[model samples]
Target: MDLYVADRSFNKLGTVNNRTSLRWVRRYRKTGEFEIHCPATSQNIEKLQRGNVIIKPGDPEAGYISYRNLQEDNDGKELLVVKGQFLTGYLNRRIIWGTEIINGLVEVAMRTLVTKNAISPTNAERIITGLSLGTLMNYTETADYQTSYANLTDELENLSNLSEIGFRVRYDGSTKSMQFETYKGLDRTAGQSVNPRCIFSKDYNNVEKQEFTESDSSFRNVCLVGGIGEGADRKLTTVGSATGLDRFEVFSDQKSLSNVVDSVTLTDAQYQALLQGKGSEVLTQNKKICVFDSSIDKNANRKYKEDYDLGDIVTNINNKWGVRLDTRIEEIEEVYEDGNEKINVVFGDEAPTLIDKIKQLRKG
Candidate 1:
């Protein structure tokens, strides 16, 4: 496949055909990345612009320019390499809320980021008109983010994960517009085609390898939530019983997770919703799966597919390995080199908690 190089201003730099390697990774609730490598020939070296951007102009979906990398091979031959994240990378350049509630924060942050001079200037406009209220709905308790500082990308991603909602960053070449969406998991009943019982084995010949892993390092049965009000009105509520102490001991303390809003009032329902969501999130992040598929080359995989994506729920039924799992595709890693391509997919569970935070605090 042919490739084109460009600058940040959308100016055409040059073209390269001797592609030695390429990788495009898509992740769930995380930033995905892409990488391209080509021979360092003088002709190609000229294409290695300082502010590199790779584009597959002729191919609509793959034509988006979104990487910057350049290097020399071991043999002293120069190479034009492009590597980085998609539009989501722009979110990493800025920090998000540290003292605001999360209910309407997403809309506000996105509105600011899409401005022409706000973050990264793009030719596309925001096409998303709304977000899934179920995914972003903060019912019970409001948060007063204290001391924590996080990038816009991460803060947004964490919000999605905490709410058990689906989040996506998509580019539409047809309209030349970018879209940010938050919704519930894929609806298999959309009347199209969703086979939750899909099998991947020698009979299918689509899967090359698969691995399953389960761990309890993050099984927190109990959750402690502290409310924001001042010294006299503040309160701490503990959820979950000590019933599973014999089986395993998993304790979660979130007393300082949020500070109360003196002016705004929160209802009992919202508090329960936040507490339930946090507990479920922790319970689901302790399992994982890895799947490998090498049938398609990297260039051919640039386009999107309907059957699977960053957050689609799929089932892997392997009788040989006694594996039957209904999980979500949390991350995807694609590697293309020397005309061969391999796709590594990670499935199951959300992300783990920050254990280091507790350790450091205790040491202090």
Candidate 2:
């Protein structure tokens, strides 16, 4: 894959050549990232600088250059390494300034969050030029969201995962603008007959290598949400119905969500429903994780981008292990090295990393 460099203004600088290796990663519910290693030539060094943009042909998202590292081997051969996240990462730089409540469609709520904080914000100084919301997909799924002074990316990812919808910020080179939109992947699992099914298995010679993980070490099925008030007066709600040995209970503090929203007081029933919704959202973040990691064979029956892409629900079967999973493609990593390319796909919810744990703690 060829890589091109662009300025912050979206002006094409030039193409990058003689690159040693590249790792381009894309995700369904979160911003993607990329890393590049190239010889420390004058042109390469000049092109791969911090604050510049990296573009890949046919890729929906463009990367933002934020880091650079220069290294020299024993033979005195210098190498320049650069890394950054996709255009969607721009949201990470901003936060929800104040309390924002949504009690309707999930798509509208996401758009509102971006608009109120990034695009055309109430504070004109905070507005991000050239950034706009794309046409809504008009999904009917509804949700109740209330956040104050929270990370925009985290909130969006939470909503996306809860609704099984994907969000992206794509750069339009011709228009020189960025568009944010929500999307849902096609159901290509065996249970769905409307679309052609995509299955990866050793029997089919499509999976070059595979690793499956099923763990409940960090799982919590039941969440007892404690809302405003103290002791017995505290509004309480529970999510999940698992009982006996299968039940794992956890507490979620939701004191910030009040009965009043935008100066309008909700009835007791409405407030109770809101608390329940928040409990459900909390449970989603602390549920069991079953992940399937696999390397796909290029010459396999199903193609990469053409057949199945990120966010699509696909099937993975291992008769020997008695495993059959139909899960969404959560992430795809493209590695290009030594003039060859390899693709790695992750299905289902991935285990949280150190950074993820930090974010969760911060939210708490």
Candidate 3:
């Protein structure tokens, strides 16, 4: 896969033909990233400079050059290493600004947030040129979101996880602009007959290697939300209906969700609804996690991108282990080295990182 370089203004530069290795990672619900290692030639050093952009073949996202390094091997061969995030990472540069209460279709709400803060804010200086919303698909999923002083990307990711939706910021070469859009992958599982099913298993010789993980160490099924009051007057709501041994309870303190906004008081029922929403969000964050990691064979029965792609729901069966999973493709990592390419796929919720654990703790 040849890599092309572009300037900050989206002007095309020459290609990097001497790259030794490239690791490109793409995600369904978050910003993607890439790393490149190449000989430190005059052209390589110039094109890989910070603030430039890297474009992979057939990829809509562009990688922003943020870090660069130079080193010499034992043989005195100079090497240049470049690393950065995809265009979606630009959301990290701004916050939600203030409290935002959303109640509507998930896609519409997401676009509203972007327009308010990034595209056409009340403060004209805050607008990001060449950024606009793409045609809406009008997905049927709806959500209730109330966030304050939060990172734009973090909030969008939270909503995406809860709704099983994905988002991206693709650069349009024709318009020389960026388009933000939401998407849902096709259902290619055995249960669905509309589209051809994609099942990976040893029997089919599609899976080269696989690992399965199931854990409930941080799981919670029930949440008791407390909102906008103290002691006996506290507005309270409970989520989840698991009974007996299945019941796992936790508390979510959302006292900051006030019933009165801009002098208008919400009805008692409205206040209770917000509490319910908060409880539901808490339960979602603290659910059981099941992950399936696999290395796919390129010549296998199901072809990548054609039969299935990121965010597509598919099936995985391991008869010997008696495991069957119908899950979404959450991430795909493409590794190119020595003129060969390999694909690593992660299905279902990925293992949480140190920062993820910290965020969960803070929420709890």
**lDDT of every model, 2 decimals:** 0.50, 0.89, 0.86
Alpha-carbon deviation at 276 in model 1, angstroms: 6.8
| Between candidates 1 and 2, the TM-score winner | 2
Cα deviation of 94 in candidate 3 (Å)? Answer: 1.0
lDDT string for model 2 (189-301, tens) is: 98889999999999999999999999888888898988888988998888788879999988888887788878898887778777877877877877688989999998889
> Candidate 3, residues 235-279: lDDT per residue as tens digits?
888888788878889998888788886688988887777677677
Tell me the spans in candidate 2 whose CA falls farther than 4 Å from its real position.
none
TM-scores, each model vs. reference = 0.67, 0.97, 0.97
lDDT of 1 at 137: 32
> Backbone clashes per model, in order?
8, 0, 0
**Worst lDDT window (10 residues) for model 1?**
126-135
Local accuracy of candidate 1 as per-residue lDDT tens digits, 11-122: 5677766788877777667667777787767777666654455565442123233445466668877667666666555555555433334343444433333332223434
Which residue pairs overlap in candidate 1's backbone?
40-78, 40-79, 69-81, 139-270, 140-270, 140-271, 228-259, 228-260
> For candidate 1, what is the TM-score?
0.67
